[model samples]
Target: LSTVIDGDRRMFAVTDFAGADGSAGLACDTSAAETIRAEHERTVRSHADTLDQLNTAVAIFDTDEKLRFFNQAFQKLWGLDSGFLLSAPSNTLLLDRLRSEGRIAEQPEWRRWKENLLSAYRAVESQEHWWHLPDGKTIRVVANPQPKGGVTWVFENLTEKMDLESRYQTAVRVQGETLDNLAEGVVVFGPDGRLRLSNPAFVALWGLTAEALKPNVHVSAIRDLCDQHAANSPWGGFVAAVTGFDDERRDRRGQIELINGNVLSYAVIHLPNGQVMITFVDVTDTVNVERALKDRNEALEKSDQLKNEFVQHVSYELRSPLTNIIGFTELLSLPATGPLTPKQREYVEYVGSSSSVLLTIVNDILDLATVDAGIMQLDISEMNIDRTIAAAAELVADRLDEHRIKLAIDATEAPASFHGDETRIRQILYNLLSNAANYAPEASTIRLTCRRLADAVEFSVHDDGPGMPPDVLESVFRRFEPRANGGRRRGAGLGLSIVKSFVELHGGTVRIETGQDRGTTVICTFPDKPSGIPDTPAGIRDAAE
Candidate 1:
């Protein structure tokens, strides 16, 4: 007996044992047959479970074009429910789905498959097929022959892969657009010195088109710029060295002048991917400002030389005539040289006095002119600080007496020897002492102190006079800035300003301190002498020579 089942139906075959036996009795072994039937049922159940767990859809079609079996995946792919059996002749939708999904091209592969299916061939294979699922997805498919008179097919969807590739292509296009639109001139060079890529600005700067920029462009072609400008040659060297280093990344910065007189500064960065990007910026304004400043400095120096020449010439020219005039006036003033009436004697005395005043004015004018011209050269020498202060004190002694000012000099612990311009040093002290005596009130005390500090010597003049206002104290050294109601009570403002300039020229500084009731104090510091120099009493005179 034989039994068969197709999905939902069953078939059975029974044998009559008595017909096959000749004079043999038949016995029914119900228990043994029942055990055999039970084993068979268990085997079939296990197979059905295995097929249900499969990921891919499996289907079978008989030679008669009737669908016999279909797996879970196959039914889901076709959007079909159970109880639906498909036949090759009745199901035009299957063919339509294959054609629309581009699985069966109207070419050799599809044509051959179609011929086999229409002829009801027992078994056939489909070459690289595809199908369109109900959900509008494309699935690559292939139908293979089975041992039984049927065909088994398998397919997988490829929608996500195609989408990813399409997006990738779009991203590349956008990146290219961004590079081209950049403002900086960018030129990329490949590893072999070929032009791999360049932005629009770069092309315009080099006076070349995209077609002209190629890897074959020689390094020598760009090296000529080095020989053209010596100062700018280092920039070219930087470019060549960085490019030839074969490094992952390198940078070079340089300057170049364009045909239109514009200066261009560029920075080039080399990337590991055989590319170099160069950016350029205009620097014409900076270059022009520096050049103009250099030219102006030269012009000022020349102008200063001319002014000094004029002052020296004038001083020499006037000195000779003044000497003679003063000598004649002195002779007339001498009583023994000539006897004269009272009126004549008075006139001669007047002429002598006027001549003396004129001589002093001329000398003062010459001294100031020389100082302004920077020709008042200092003669560095050694001198006694105490003696220098005494001489300065004597020079201003009469003024001090006239004002009834108490003049005190404190040089008890000053340096015994120093190297500097003695005459200029004395001049500075005399000016300070004289200014203090003249500007302070009649009963005020003027103090002059000199002391040796760590690295230098300090000289200060302190006066207990009506002090300068806060505003005037700060600018006391500025030329011609009058103090105490426009300096009506003192000498012209040039004296202190001149003192400051000459002191600074000797590498020293001056400062003033004052308040409403507190008197003004002026301090000047001079650098100390080194131990190598010898001390001499005649040091001051020798320095003057």
Candidate 2:
């Protein structure tokens, strides 16, 4: 049969059939058949339009493995030209083109992979595959076989999603390992008041087993276990913090003393996700050390007070008897007192000198005690530098003469006068000179150099004698640590100590320069006007050269 539709001629085959009554019949229903064929074509077009609108790249291949249809996304995903996609390339040819373009990773068994992918055409169920493209794109491919003997391929870009999953897994693993190795006990509770996370330290600190601290255990159940270990448990607060509906959600920190004598410092932190994290650190040793230090400090203060008082009493007691002895010795040497033989006279002189030295030692002890008590006050005043030097030189003149040591005065650079406590300056110079005399070699010259600097006056006493060794020089200014150290005689070791104390009182510094075989020099620098603030002495140096 032939018909005309839309200006085009269509032809259909007619069939002749016989009926049950032996009659001949002919059938030609071309119009109804054309209508059904047109409807089916429209339905296929509608499905193709829907697939084109999807983000997933879709392609359809026929039983011949030739590409029949593809969406815009498929062209964009592979970066292929539209002309090439419309050329009806076979599935294997398409894969080969993509591989040659380096859009997909190279396959070691290319033929095998291709054969396996093509197997989806005969598969009863959908086949899934993962393709990691060379451009770092991950594509999830699903091949769904159609009832009419073709496959519909879906390509989903899952690179970002898979990357996010991988990073999340790594973060969780790192956090778990970090929490496990921490020294502090840590526990986290969910908003539902159930234990969500905890470390081994938390379990050990609470004296609980791993089973007792298992995930999903209620806070109240953990609280009961904590109460047995601690006199006052902090878990009660933790439970409220985790489950309570307070809007503020303030964090808290406190200390708890356990029945076993351990002290734990704890902090309650509220996370943004409605979880509570509690951390505990043991501070038992730290607390004990603080208490012991406080007690020792108090005892030391009391002992220092007793020592000051005892030193003052003993100094006064010895001073009175020493004054009487010195006075009687002088009286015995007087002409009115019975005339003494030369031996007797020498003995009296010795007694007087010995008493004087003892009195000086007692006075030094008293002065040091006053300094230790922090009550030593300087009498600040202006004094003639030349007169002070003269007086100190006179005081040590006898000793220098006995040692056959000559004093060299060099005050060419010294100021005429400076503001200072006249008595203390005199004492400072006297101590320096006396110390020099004690160590000066027989017939050796001791140099006394004084200079006026821009901001201070400097005084130095250098002795030409066997110098101190490293060991003796280390403690040269320490009180009561007397070492003969090649000196004519060992002193009470107060001369240098007194010098340091008095010079520092004027806000000055003391420095000793000495070494074995080399002579010793003691330098004292006084501020032009007292700074009124004492400082630690400057360092000692080895003056071997």
Candidate 3:
């Protein structure tokens, strides 16, 4: 027998088991049919129990649009009595009863809403609606059209859920307000180094528009923008910190100076959920204050240096002619083949003396100019310290004699030899002695001492002259401030300055020890080996010049 079984425990279709005659009645198995019917009843009861346990309201309609099955939850969802639901009303009649009893919301156009809801019966796919009933409950209804000509409607109550979601959104809005108004820039990046959230302050700090900060932008793109505003960008560090998965995550903090003169302090913190939070704070005012003070000091020093260069170069260019004038004047004053009267002799003497004074001024200016130009190259070689000192003393011997200052050489503590520039060393010694000669009184003992220490050779000229007053000592090494106090002649004031400059050029130092009552001791130190680079600023020939 060939037979078909169905859910209602009834025969659905049959096929004849006869041969060519087609005369055999289907031999149905009564016992197997009873067994299939029992299985169907058990399966339907199990499904009904499962649906009753659900929170969602589920209702099914027959091919004629009459209510066929519904769980207890479905009745509760609509606040309907079980008696009316069991009566099996048509789908439209059920909706009409619910609408009349104020269970469903009254639509703006009732006939139109009813027609729309009824369209689910012929719909080939599912339809959904969020219904706000007149009883103040919200229902999320899903209408799924069946393959066999009917529809299944599932209603979900979402009133409490929506209320909670609304509160959460409100809290998020408040937090967003707080972040937008903060002065500190805040950026949150995901574990992939892609940007997740950034506050307005973060965008404004970098001077970028909000449109540039779209969702899921990689950290490198932001770095590129940040680097556009910074000379030496610190964004590379930020990118590395964001994408790093190292076992140790240390919080990083640093201060960065931008090309636009803004200084920002940044901190990167690793979040617990594999995100990185970076904060930037503008500290430009504090950093600029310190930088401004430092720049001002540097500017003043540069101005002073430039002024020295001006005096030096002009003096150097003028010295050659001035020297010729002094020399020729002295030659003319001498009686080689002719003799002059008393008045002519006086005039010649005056001319010679004035030329000599002018020559002295020109020479001072040239020496200072050479030092100011910073190209004062030294001839580094081993030198006889005593001989160098002797040559320097002889150069200033006449001035010493004119001032009545007796030169006393003290080499008791002196070295045999040292390594330095010979000509420059001689000049340094001569200038110090000349400075002392111009200040020392007549018959005063001017002592020259050379002491050899472990690392350097120290030379000192001690003059038993009236010491410099507070004001003169303050600017003792300033060029072109000529002041002769009881001396035979004033100087161009470049003597001490030259000594200091040349000493420093040899990587040495100069110092003065003097007070009102004490005689002055001007000390100059030269290193034994001359191993250090000169402390003077670098000299480069200008390309344009």
**In TM-score terms, which candidate is top?**
2
Candidate ranking under TM-score, highest first, comes to 2, 1, 3
Residue lDDT tens for model 2, 1-545: 77776897765667767778786656454776787889999999999999999989999999998999999889889999988888999999999999999998999999998999999999989999999998999999999999999998999999999999999999999999999999899999888889889998888887899988888999899998899998788878888888999999999999999999999999999997898999999999999999899999889767767766887799999999999999999999999998999999999999999999999999988887767656788888889999999999999898888868899999999999998988988888888888878778889999999999999999999998788888888788877777787787888878888888788778888899988878899999999987675633342111110
**TM-score for candidate 1:** 0.53
- List TM-score per model, in order: 0.53, 0.77, 0.51
- Clash statistics: count for each candidate: 5, 0, 0
Candidate 1 residue pairs that clash: 57-74, 194-215, 195-214, 195-215, 381-420
Off by over 4 Å in 2: 1-57, 62-64, 68-84, 95-116, 119-126, 131-138, 145-150, 157-164, 190-194, 218-224, 232-255, 267-276, 289-304, 531-545
lDDT per residue for candidate 1 within 65-102, as digits (tens), equals 45666667766766654554343333235655556665
The runs of at least 3 residues in candidate 3 whose Cα sits more than 4 Å from the true structure, single-residue gaps closed, are 1-273, 283-313, 466-475, 481-490, 532-545
Return the lDDT, model 3, position 212. 88
Candidate 2: residue 294 Cα off by (Å): 4.7
lDDT top scorer: 2
Q: Root-mean-square deviation of each candidate, in angstroms?
A: 13.2, 7.8, 15.8
Of the pair 1 and 2, which is ahead by lDDT?
A: 2
